[model samples]
Target: MIFVNILISFIVIIILQLLGMVILSKMTPFNDMEELNKGNVAVGLVFGGQFLGTAIILGVAAYTNSSIWYMALWFAVGYVCLLLSYWIFDWLTPGIKLSDQLKDGNKAVALLLACVYIGIGFAVSSLII
Candidate 1:
């Protein structure tokens, strides 16, 4: 029974992570996989940060919630918060369009945005009771 429960949790987490990635890909103007294939380091870093951020949130959610439904709910909340942080970062940096800069292969912008996402992930994870 314990093994089955663990397996289910693992599968659920993987599904949620893939869903998050899909949503993120839709949100961005450029194709992430294509850019990654083109050896765009900036896109790779930003995507890496997103993956790590979601994983952190999912980890906390799975650890804290006993019910699968509750875990999914909390994961959704964390995912929204993670998405909002990107918009907030854009808002904070006036007159600079983050998505545009990222599409243009700006390494500095990507690095800062990646840091913002990861930093927000850490902060949000701490709040996930």
Candidate 2:
């Protein structure tokens, strides 16, 4: 029962994070996955930033002052794990220079990437948790 509860809760977190990324992507002017995949710095930063942001949100939610918070805590745990996955991906994907472009002030690309990062983190975390 405990494992089932954890699994369901983790799945919920992944879905919510994906939903959030989709919404965030739509809000931005640019929506090019190809461009985003081409090592755009903006995308990388957003990817990294969104995970960090989601982790914090989840962390706070874990405090469990309310039903919403309790649910959020489960998501938070999954998200942190997801963030670790990102670090692993970065370490593994050597020579992928997205950081340079991010420093060049590219908002559209960044927003797009933020979505991807969060999406990946959410997915990975959901699976493991």
Candidate 3:
């Protein structure tokens, strides 16, 4: 029963996070998937942003009165959430423009993309916990 609860909770959190990311992507002006697939430095920034965002949010969730099951489940769900966010972004903005910008080493655009991912990730994680 405990394992089942953990799995269900994890799935719920992942779905919620994915939904949040979709909403965020529409609101943001940047997309990171284009750069990531093209093997650019922007990928590093995106990863960094995602890592920090997930760490802080999951860390906080792990704290407080959350059970061990909740913490572990949230952490696992967060990773799936991140990937879903990227997939959703690609689907929503299928144009090649973002890739073009990254190819030219546009730091501003890269930063914007990273910020969006981190912001959304953090926001969704907080809501779940």
Give a tens-digit lDDT track for model 2, residues 9-112.
67766776775566545533555354467765665567556755575455445434335456565565555554554455546657633343354547664565
Which of candidates 1 and 3 is the stronger one according to TM-score? 1
lDDT of 3 by residue, 62-99 (tens): 55434756755665676567667666665676763554
**What ordering of candidates by lDDT runs from best to worst?**
1, 3, 2
Report the number of backbone clashes for model 2: 5
Q: Which of the two candidates, 1 or 2, achieves a greater TM-score against the reference?
A: 1
- In model 3, the Cα lDDT at residue 88 comes to 68
The TM-score that candidate 3 achieves is 0.54
Prediction 1 TM-score vs. true:
0.90
If both were scored by lDDT, which would come out higher, candidate 1 or candidate 3?
Answer: 1
lDDT for each residue of candidate 1 in 1-129, tens digit (9 for 90 to 100): 989999999898889889988888787888888888898888877888887887887788778876788778877887898789888888999988887887788999988878877877777788878
For this target, which candidate reaches the highest lDDT against the unseen true structure?
A: 1
Q: Which stretches of candidate 1 lie above 4 Å from their native place? A: none
Candidate 3 segments exceeding 4 Å error: 1-40, 97-106
- The Cα local distance difference test for each model comes to 0.83, 0.55, 0.61
Candidate 2 lowest-lDDT run of ten? 59-68
